[model samples]
Target: MLAGLSADYYTRLEQGRERNPSAQVLDALSRALELDADQEMHLYRLARLVPASRGGGGREPVSPMLLQLMDTYAATSAFVLNRTLDILAMNRLAEALFSSFADTDNLVRMVFTDPAGPEFFTEWHRAAQSTVASLRLAVGHDPHDARLTRLVEEISAASPAFRQLWEQGHVRGKTAEAKELLHPDVGRLSLTFQAFDVRDKPGQQLVIYQAQPGSPSDHALKLLESLSANYRDHEDADLP
Candidate 1:
């Protein structure tokens, strides 16, 4: 009775026999369950008592202004990701940073299935955990999203680790974090990344990584920038 509901009522709610739970009841349940902000929002979505805050699935066009803004970060690695962790757009340095991966389309896939994942992320376990948590938060936003369903299914089938983590029920959104990467070309890179939600485009996150000024990682980032530029130039030359 922490939710102030009788056992039978709670059982009916759990069994889906009782539909149309009022907002007050949901709020009580959320409080009783000690759910976090993300989890609470997910609860509302699952109940169909609230509308999704953003699009459920599919890729959206990145704003041209945002693309130009990302281009301005010459030395930094910057990219935009949707709720499903799909890399919708990225700058040259960001692409170069993930160059070793066979695919850089999805963050969860990159962390779990990519062969380079274990080596590229210096703290592989942390990366895996955070990726799963982030996906969990996404699921809360739109549980019926077909693309997200397929992604979760594909990864769960392929990775026992992902399965284990998925069962843990952790929910979190991407936030600022310090990440270490062992780039194939640049060696170890200690970088700080910040995740910002795009105000105009809900479910889109802009992530940027930077190394401390005058640090070894900073020098490495400069080298990577040059390499990225040269590689892009070569690709352009090959187009003829």
Candidate 2:
């Protein structure tokens, strides 16, 4: 059915002569391109038709109170992410988790471009799928952000795994779930994660990971905390 599009019509839409497409038209194009849930949402973002009430600003300001809140979780793994999933700040325990990676700050880059991504994540397939979906949700509210745009393009070109997931058009926000990770030092770890939206900042979220009491993961976190007791998150204004 998508093949029925006239060349002129397609060309006009592409050239921006037709700014908005009807829902049926968008759905047909989605089918024509084999767009998945994530890709279909991305298509809508590119078309600039997502409701403005839902789409907020491109960048969120990190509140001082938020940073203070993160400090309270010094022994636990906690971090803040902006709308595009940029790591704005993290507690010491969170920093320890990524101490081995060069791009320790950016979650997406660490997942998609790191040499140890597959092994370290252990559940790479599902993690990648969920990440791509979160990214779709983030961008749906602010697609013109250059940082987000560049990060997506780079990940698409660098990792086929990310590209595949991104095409699915899936969108999901963070939910309470157990995560498993293979630490380079401590081996396997299991932790529960919670994501909280910062109501003051439209796209900011606070995430914390904790292990259940008396679990192997809990013991490992204790060890990790001791090892990184003196570690401090470096301040790098130029860091992206």
Candidate 3:
């Protein structure tokens, strides 16, 4: 056999009858299937052979230094996300960029379950696919996470599209990509975003969005920034 396993053993493995597969056997199977690094690691997780990498079941606080760094990006949109795509923290511009959503708590929820999602994201289907793929990558890191499990279930129950895409078994982390968004106030925006891992903080990622300088999107971002600032000022004035 390609995996160096007898026919009956492989069949049993496929049928879930073989519960305790050795690391060597998994390695043989991974090699035979030509799995990529992420997929191979996901396989180990599925077999309960790998320990979960995400620590603490609850949300972790964003570092104050990181928060200060985000604040320095006055013209750009920046936010921090946990493994389950929870928006742990956001700068002013980032909050303005997503202000249309009723809840900006989870990226997956924003893309899939939010009523404003489809209209806000110009390329809705592509956004949905990427969001699902990112979540799949997160699952590989911590399959036993209760919050993640609940999120999957809630979205799956509410959205047939989410259910379909999630069943496709795509696994990928968030990567640099161009995003086209339709803002309620500013109209269309074309921006590119990049993701970075927070040092010493496993499962935490910092993402930043920027538009090409001197372009219409760049102007729009500035306008949005001003609008966000004005709105915050008004809210503060009304607090008393």
Candidate 4:
């Protein structure tokens, strides 16, 4: 793991305080580990922090065009999420549709931390497991992402259930699927999920949930709008 460096030097590198590593050394480690593109980048990021270390090679932000594209689909519930499912942005319909998740920007945290998640999900166990598996697949795709590594560690500590699901090493892309959301105000609304690739942002995806026409879900959607307005009104009233 350390190449020709002394054990003490390797410890410093791991600790992120030393910064004298050469690009050659970084490349050597990346190749030695047989790292994929994502993991290789992560190693560079870690090495960049050391003194005399190369600086500022982190991932760029999602492109402005991509943001606009997602926002333009305003009538639908669309969101841009990273491989780790961190919600980067959403349109108004998404905000209204995911009212309960409005408080937290991280989808995984919202799912596992909220007591309402289980109730809202008609297939709670499968949905939860699928999410954990997705995260595991992301780690495999980019083992070098320190942020993702930290997130996994944090969630593992927070929920043993999540840990069990993660260790299973499942990998599957989210696809078109129907879901029944049990909204407190709107009751059960069945919706279909569709996922699209964000062309400019590799490793990021756009997901949308649309209710079928002329269904009970349509009525529930109306009620959800009413509930959302009521909540917003109360929030406005509370503001100074």
Which whole-number lDDT from 0 to 100 does residue 171 have in model 3?
80
lDDT of 1 at 179: 98
lDDT of each structure?
A: 0.90, 0.78, 0.90, 0.70
Listed in order, each prediction's TM-score against the native is 0.87, 0.74, 0.87, 0.67
**Pairs with steric clashes in candidate 2:** 36-168, 37-168, 37-169, 37-170, 38-168, 38-169, 38-170, 39-169
Q: Using alpha carbons, what is the TM-score of model 3?
A: 0.87
Model 3 steric clash total? 0
Error of 4 at 28 (Å): 29
Better of 1 and 2 by lDDT: 1
Model 4: residues with Cα > 4 Å off, grouped in runs:
1-62, 72-75, 226-240
Question: Candidate 3, residue 208: CA error in Å?
Answer: 1.2
Minimum summed lDDT over a 10-residue window in model 4 is located at: 49-58
Instruction: Please say which candidate is ahead in TM-score: 2 or 3.
Output: 3
For candidate 2, lDDT tens digit of each residue in 1-240?
464678888899988898788777787898888876656866787676666534353455578988888878855799888767788888888888777677766778888888777777889877787778888776666657687889889999998888888887678777567788988877788988999878877767889999998999999988888777644323344357
Superior by lDDT: candidate 1 or candidate 4: 1
Comparing 1 with 4 on TM-score, the higher-scoring candidate is 1
